[model samples]
Target: MPGKRPLNAAIIPSAKRERKAITLDIKLEVLRRFEVGEKLSQIAKALGLAVSTVATIRDNKEKIKASSQVTTPLRASRLTRHRSAVMENMERLLSVWLEDQSQRNVPMSVSAIQEKAKSLFDDLQRQQGESSQTEKFSASKGWFVRFKERHCLPHFKVNSTSPGSNADTYPDVLKSLIEEGEYTSRQVFNVDETGLYWKRMPEGMFISVEEKAEPGFKSSKDRLMLLLGGNAAGDFKLKPLLVYRSEDPEALKGYSKPNLPVIWRSNKKAWATRAIFHEWFTYFFCPAVEKYCAQNNLTNKALLILDSAPCHPVNLSDLSDNVRVEYLQDSTADSMQPMGQGVASIFKAHYLRRIFEHILEATDGEDKATIREFWRNYDIVDAVDNIAVAWEELKPATMNSVWKKIWPECVHFQSFSQTDNIAWLQRNIMALAKNVAFEEVVEADVGRLLQSHEEDLSNEELMQLERERAVGEGENEDAPPALRQLTTEALSVAFSHFEAGLQILTSNSPDEEWKFKVSRAINDAINCYRELYNEKKRRSKQLS
Candidate 1:
């Protein structure tokens, strides 16, 4: 017999209430925070989730992260669902391609993405030797709709802005803020990243040089990204941040990353990511600025100006109380961003000039083996040293002059003529190129090489980059080598060399004042090492 129903049974709710579904995006965010040492309760409160749910997500983090590898992490907001292996492979490759394009600031269209998907699927099928009976991928509009929602293409903005539209208005707005805040030139800084084919020469130059020497020589397309920044005053330049394809390249073995001339970081593509930028801001940028402010007797407050790059996180302002971050107008980067307004160009010219200088120096005696070794051993380490030298070559006035377009008031009046002249640099570079036996290289070739860094990757190049990334899979990024302790013996030997060199110079010199000045400079430079040597001696004695 059926049980008698209650009078209000129709209006009564079921005993078990439906639980709210937590999207994959939220779970991923929770995992990121957890990995970064955030407390479970804090993450729960921040995301408006229960502590239990946060804990559950943390427990299942490995699964969640593995699932995200199949698609874009941020775009996978929906619940996890099973996907075929072929589709996963295609989408994963497609995501990497999309990210690469975004990093280069290349715009994407729906048709283009659809076409790329189909092509990637075809490539995957050929590689796997799949049977024709395998399910076909249409890459139709419906699939794209789902893909777009899943990956968050264009990162929620179809386009940033019409090119150069905000050039005039943005400056005025920034000027008003600068005035209101009473920010000095020293308080404002600008940063931007650019691609560098670190080991490669001008387009065909490398191929020609390499082919003549060795049949096995291959043109190196290896690239790295550099982040350069400086205060408007130009008195303070931040150490460049270098992102490379491999964190631990063979040439850089046994080097302490912290002591590197640049802030070193890496990923498979060598493109700067949000996490990398955030890490830089927190650890390197803030501490350096604080120390600079203290030494210069300026207020600790600072204003960091950035372009609308996809790598920069929106929460940059929340990272530091003393440092304020502002973004320049979108699409107007070419016209209004201080770094793009001649600064980056000048830096690139300096870097190129250094490369040419190295080649000439290496081939001065025309030693074939030396030149071959130079070409072979020229790796990230060499590139890094050259980058440091080139950066040092930038005059303060040149740095200040770059602000003239974006904020004229911030620019100091000075003779910035010589170092900032792009044409002069090009002439010097051309001279060096000819000296290095690149007789056909011209000023126009140098110009084109600089422009190539900003150009979009071609289809073939993109495929090659994807293949390189695939080859790097399953390998963890190696941590930088630990700082090696200075030994008393090494310190003493280094000092002996310095003293000997100074004595030799002093003896050879005829001018008394010049000798005295050189000796004084050498002594001053080695003073820090002298102290370290003494400290090491004291420690040895105590241990004994």
Candidate 2:
């Protein structure tokens, strides 16, 4: 019963719709741009966002980042509106539940998953004393679909796994590859991939709270995949493939990818994906084998043994007849895998020792208090080189002994002395830790860390840890300018690093053989230093 007001009295709706909630990724982009000296207006215009929106993102990034992530949808989303924690808690628990079910071989039907998600969401809400919100979780098919994709779970297809009984037939298959294909033990190869947490120390080094902090550094999550392969005769070992958690790490900027010390690859997860596996087989594995066979005067014949991982590429379409790819029967890895015998263990043991060696090498002669600072520079780029060296150190004996359980026919000698070798490595490890490193290390500390360096990770941990490093991570750091060139200072640092390694080896060499080895190393290093020094002197003369 009221008449329309005049134009001046007319009310106007707010022009700014409650701006759509900015996502974590957008927030990150804003922050990254700001750090690189971009103006607020530039960032805003580039992203097609308001200047104030960009400013808010930059201002509240740190506080907002800790709470918001892609995994937790925006507060504006209907599902997570007023109860983001409920969604987060539910997602984490359901993720674990789904994984447990998968491990138990329970069928994960889409409808079944949806029901579970809804139940878990309901249970979480009650636990959080928010049951009165009156908004029930449907875990609707649409939401479930997105969630499944986000977790990288394959479509609703149930995996049909049959009990494997053809394990005994594997020998006959190998015989056919050898007798029919005429591939020798040297040409017959078995490859396997393993995960390593390079940063994890033994449990004794830290308390449970510190070691397993939920939001802190998870050694279990900081992982790399080593794709290792060797023949039964141990006469040939493929160049190891090392995958790290970066595409173009700043630590590796100066190095040419073609001349990398190892076959390097990267992904967020640092895992060997199907595409990566195929690429390796076609390019690296095939060429390497072809070259090896040429040197051995054998036909271009090769056989590859693999495990039954779904992600493993089964087809070798690129190299058809010359190479035969065969997968081991399911449930036969522990008993039949050539890699399981001792190749992987030897590789891992050496890999870890070399890591500590590099750390010691890098920190050599630095002040005791400044020792920790040097450790920061030893990133995955350095770790890759160390890993390559470690893989090369694998003794033929250890590589050949791997066939004992699967193909004893190929084992010429017993691996009993492996224990003695490991003990020796442990002793040297202790020596290096105490003599070279700032801290003292015991045999147990050395053993546990090296032994457990590759934890038997659950499938979920494998996926989570394989996620790519954050956006700004692989970029160069603000401090500790990148060492791109071999300057005079670089030469001196190299010598110092080598000197520390020499001292440790000198102290730990068990016998005359070992002592002679260390002495030879010292002479070689000094000769190298002299060569560099002379080269530098000549360069200076030319300049003058």
Best by TM-score: 1
lDDT of 1 by residue, 1-544 (tens): 9999887565566678544557667787787667645578868988888999999998887888888878765555443434455566677678777877676555567787889899888877776675633868989999998887756665622454554477778778888878877788998999988887776567557544654465432335667899998999988899999998777888888999978999998867788888888888876788788778888998888889887678888888897888989887555665777776676778888998998788767767744445566776677888899999999998888888888877887777555663449889998898887777777786777888877777655444555675675565455433332334568888888988998998899899999999999999888656656865886799789999
Clash totals for all candidate models: 0, 3
- Clashing residue pairs in candidate 2 are 268-467, 268-468, 269-466
Full-model lDDT for every candidate? 0.76, 0.66
Cα RMSD, model 1: 11.2
Residue lDDT tens for model 2, 61-169: 6775565544545542532233355665566556655643432223457777777777777765776685545666789888877687645665433533556546566
- lDDT comparing candidate 1 with the true structure: 0.76
What local lDDT does model 2 show for residue 382?
A: 68
Q: All predictions: root-mean-square deviation over Cα?
A: 11.2, 14.3
Model 1: lowest-lDDT 10 consecutive positions = 475-484
State every prediction's TM-score relative to the real structure.
0.65, 0.58
